[model samples]
Target: MSGAKLVQGNEACVRGALAAGCNFYAGYPITPSSEIAEIMVRRLPDAGGVFIQMEDEIASLATVIGASLAGSKAMTATSGPGFSLMQEHIGFATMAEVPCVIVDVMRGGPSTGLPTSPSQGDIMQARWGTHGDHPAIVLAPSSVGEVFDLTVKAFNLAERFRTPVILIYDEIIGHTRESVVLPDRVDIVDRSRPNGNPSTYQPKAPAANGVPPMVAFGDGYRFHVTGLTHNEHGFPTTDPGDTEALITRIHDKVYDHQDEISAVEEFMLDDAEVAIFAYGIVGRSAREAVLRARRAGMKVGLIRPLTLWPFPYAQVADVAAGIDTLLVAEMNLGQLIGEVERAVAGTTEVIGHLRADGEPITPADLIAALPDPAGART
Candidate 1:
């Protein structure tokens, strides 16, 4: 706890969540992500938090969401099939604007495809799986160090935005152990509470940040909240005009402030002809490739995403200026590369290096794909 320690990504997630004041965790132990729940079971209660292994992933997320409504910093962990089951409840939390975190240690899948394998296959799922037009923040960590930092950031972002935040991780990063330095609890941001009379308080009323004041069930406010479109008083509404307005606002809250939510780390990109776009486990390799290429006098660079949801598109475009090419590497066939292409515009030749065999790509794998623009294509 004092200095850096060797730890796995999933274990670091549990540690970071606990430090962020997560008091309740309910999750199913699925491959890749099970270490998160396992870590919580062993440590949560010691920190005055509660941890329960539920009947299934559906029940696991349901239980955590219930705890969140009761004013607890709650979370659940899962992989592919389990994430599929939690979709309905994820929608419930989104519609209700519940503040919570969901740790998704991704694996190869459509349905139980490869349990012990890795994949960025859930990139779109994490964004659109829950149904409806709700907006939520999602973070992807490339290293075990980020696994700690981003997990805490997810909780803070969820509470600040009053929405569910997904901490998406891949199996390669989740189960891999690395030395990580824990920060001194970087200012936890909790939702502002209503200070006036409990009788006059309205849970449905939006705060200055567009987040409504939330109190536990046993609180004297006892305000009503539902998944349906509601007014300031938390009642269901059938008015499409009003519903449309509210939905737009929800999307704006996060997207409009993406500068604050999105983050990325660029390496040697200031003078490179080719840029490799990567994230999660593949990013670790991408970093090495950048260093290797620079040492080899290849003049290549890297762009690693820290925030996947509110993607650092503008940053990418800025770095891509005058660049000759972009290479996106990932465990999935191609997911985030599309975003990189759109961000780079027509200034560069965009391409991709993909691995879909449920295994992580190596630094050499991505480096070998970097095209020498001055020398022409392969």
Candidate 2:
């Protein structure tokens, strides 16, 4: 349990959540993501936390929202299908500004496509699964240690912004084991509480940070929470200005802090003419490919995103500014590659190596897809 113990990525997530002060977990079991819930059930009670296996993913997220409103840090885990079922509540959590975490261990999808195989097919879904326009904070970890690190960060971001945060990784990463040295503790952020008198409290009033200070249900502040467009007083509103303000504020809360929220690993990008843009499990393969390319006297690098939403356009743009060609590799046919293309904006040639056959894109696959280094400089 100490000093570089071997840990599965899914197991590390539970450990990280506990360290981040997660005291409640409610989830239905599903492949790839089931380990997180299974571990939480056994470990939570011992940590003085509560764990509940809801009837399904929808109820699972609903229970987590209820627990979060009660002021406990809450979380849930699911795979592609379960995640699909949670979309409605995901939107509700966004509209209500509920602070919580949802972990999605992705598998080949489009309706139960591959239950036990690895796939990054949920990349776009994680960003836009919920209906309507809403801010999304999604973290994708490529390794066991990063799974732990980002899980803790996910909770912190959720509390800080008072919005749902998602931790997404492919099945391979979830099932893979690696030696990771988890820290004894990590910095924790709790949702800001009401400062003024409870008599005049307005739950949805935006602070300077664009996020309203949250008052838990048991904290004596009576406020409303609804999916309908609401006023600062948290009551239903149809006024044009109120609706616009409500929607815009929720977005600004995250976008205004995107620099803090966005994270990427740029490996050997300097002086490199070619770069690979990848995330999740493919990030590891891309990293190895970069090393192999370098050994072949090719100037190849990698841009592995840790925080996927807000899309890291600025980071990708900077990399594209210098590189001659940016190759995107993912387990899906094409999802994030379009985003990468937008980020590059013709600054560099963009190409993709995509697959959705429930198998990973290996280092050799990426290396083969990469442009000829000898001609890349021309």
Candidate 3:
């Protein structure tokens, strides 16, 4: 937590995984996200862990799930198209309740999109990328330093809830050079270990918080885990009651304790009639807007959500209560802004400074959207 060095966003992600006790990474090299694999190759081995380059995105995701089942803190990283390729496996991890981290460094795309460029186009995909009605715990890190912090939190959330956690970042955040202060590994949280005899342990036994103690496959507990909804004994269940209970618990455990999961940063929002809301690199531009708006005597503010999923609805809603015009700005064409609308209802007019080109959202882009915003900053 001392000296800071300039590092790429992908490498910072690797450090985050390492600090979070992630020991297994199985991924195919994809632009933007490829640096995650690259850094893991050089770092995991030195930490007495394993790294693998699977043949394809599907295999990469599948192998990571397998590693998680085998009792390792596992993860895989990919960009937009690769994220598309891993959908079924992501579904597999979700249904199976496997704890692993999937870092999607977003690039422009419908197919391959923009490989080396930044885009927030995958916002919806991350929400419902996998097939079915499972819940997602997605984290978006706006800065290189934040990418490291949130990666550790992503693993903790995944392991705690027994689900696949997605760390969504844009190409801008993944490749940007910034100074990040590394944390001591001891300060990070590791997954809870089951505290019982291997032969007698039960992976499906419900705990007070709905999270069953996790034991790696070879290390101890012998239990069945499948994508199929299962009984408390871990065997697939045909009972409608059984399926309902499993799915509900998966969603509740996270939703119930949202205060622990939701993270955001506020900038000069107090007493402002208008505010700009955003995250990732877009937030930086919004920050600049706040500064300029304040200098020009305009009552404007900014709200940046560090965690995208488990959506910061409550926080955004609370802040919206005091504002008149709430502007939502992002690199995507009004994706997150809709969430702002949902939170604010029709009480606040939410303006959008939307973008879809393979370029970073700039301060000029946002300030240009508002006519005389700086003049009203007083």
Which candidate achieves the best TM-score against the true structure? 2
lDDT (0-100) at residue 372 of candidate 2? Answer: 96
What is the descending lDDT order?
2, 1, 3
Global fold similarity of model 1 (TM-score): 0.95
Which regions of candidate 3 deviate over 4 angstroms? 196-200, 371-378
Compare candidates 2 and 3 on lDDT and give the better one: 2
Deviating ranges (above 4 Å) for candidate 2? 373-378
The sequence of per-residue lDDT tens digits that candidate 1 reaches over residues 265-297 is 888888888888888888889989888888777
Which is the winner by lDDT between candidate 1 and candidate 2? 2
Best by lDDT: 2
Q: Please write out the lDDT profile of model 3 over residues 243-292, one tens digit for every residue.
A: 89988887787788788888889889888878899888888888998888
lDDT over C-alpha atoms for residue 6 of model 3: 90
Lowest summed-lDDT stretch of 10 residues in model 2?
Answer: 369-378
Q: Give a tens-digit lDDT track for model 2, residues 1-378.
A: 457788999999999999999999999999989999889999999999999989999999999999999999999999999999999999999999999999999988889889999999888898899999999999999999999999999999999999999999999999999988889989999899888999999999988999999988878889998999999999999999999999999999999999889999999999899999999889999999999888888899999999999899988999999989999998988999999989888878999999999888999999889899475321
lDDT of predicted model 2 = 0.93
Better of 1 and 2 by TM-score: 2
> What is the Cα-based lDDT of residue 158 in candidate 1?
86
Taken over the whole model, the C-alpha lDDT of each candidate is 0.86, 0.93, 0.85
